[model samples]
Target: MENKDHILLFRVGKSELERIQQKKAEVGIRSMAAYLRKMALEGICIQLDLGDELTEIRALLGRCSSNLNQYARVANTSGNIYAEDIKDLQQLMTEIWDNQRALLKRLSDI
Candidate 1:
């Protein structure tokens, strides 16, 4: 490990500080010093706006979870599971995989 024996200090304007804080939050970094150091050293931060993809994934997962719950309840009470329920789950899985692949492709492009 490298020993830290030096102090590097700098100042930023109010607007600049606000921008830094905003970017830090966007990247989910809690330490301002670390964020600044990373920016200074790496000089490249790729912030992907995955909101739409995440929302779609969440909706699909919710539907899949609801279907699974219903199927479980039916099976518990009736002691039998339907082929249709299994098919629905398989279809949901396919959609989830497709979305994941699309997201990966987008990330790889970056």
Candidate 2:
């Protein structure tokens, strides 16, 4: 990758700016812009720490899909299906279907 210099702007008190310069010198960071960016990135990264959340969501979706298919088949076959029960199962299936469509759309966009 090509390295490019980007101009950044910051506002700080005189004392704070002096402290920053002193620390940059101590760390042998000659360019204030580079030094500030490096230190700021070290302190915070945005694309963070979602492995557990992703795993949990995956498990939940798997279970929901399995139950949805099972219930859908039962509702289709069972001769004495109550209206409310059928509606409930259909709603759950529809919700899962909608979520799947939305997920696919987002993946395609990405």
Candidate 3:
């Protein structure tokens, strides 16, 4: 994302400004511009840690994919596949899917 260099302004009554401050406090948002932008554009705004979690999940899946590729190479070179390695890979996949489902459910709640 680019830094927001543009400016936009509007006037509001004193009471309206106070109300906006109160809402920002209640929402625990520190950035007035960000809070206002979300309120104006989205109608409803929420703060969720899902972005961080999803990034972590993506990293984990990348590692899992790398490991799978490594195992495939080993199997091709050795003419063998280990049952235990397959089970471990399956378990890892299952856990990743379960986490994705949970995250989706949380998003659906919003």
Q: What's the distance in Å from true for residue 43, model 2?
A: 7.7
The lDDT, on a scale of 0 to 1, for candidate 1 is 0.92
Clashing pairs in model 1?
A: none
Return whichever of 1 and 2 wins on TM-score. Answer: 1
Better of 1 and 3 by TM-score: 1
lDDT of 3 at 2: 75
Error of 2 at 1 (Å): 33
User: For model 2, how does the per-residue alpha-carbon lDDT over 1-110 read when each residue is reduced to its tens digit?
Assistant: 75766666779999999999999999998998778878987855445444655565576577667766776777789844567766665676666666666666655654
Mind giving the per-residue lDDT tens digits that candidate 1 earns over 20-66?
Answer: 99999999989988888888898877898999998998899999999
Q: lDDT (0-100) at residue 4 of candidate 1?
A: 62
Models, CA RMSD each: 10.6, 11.7, 13.0
How much does candidate 1 score in TM-score?
0.61
What would the per-residue lDDT of candidate 3 be over residues 24-100, giving only the tens digit for each residue? 98999899988998888877658887886698679769878988998999999998999988987888788788888
Model 1, stretches more than 4 Å misplaced?
A: 1-42
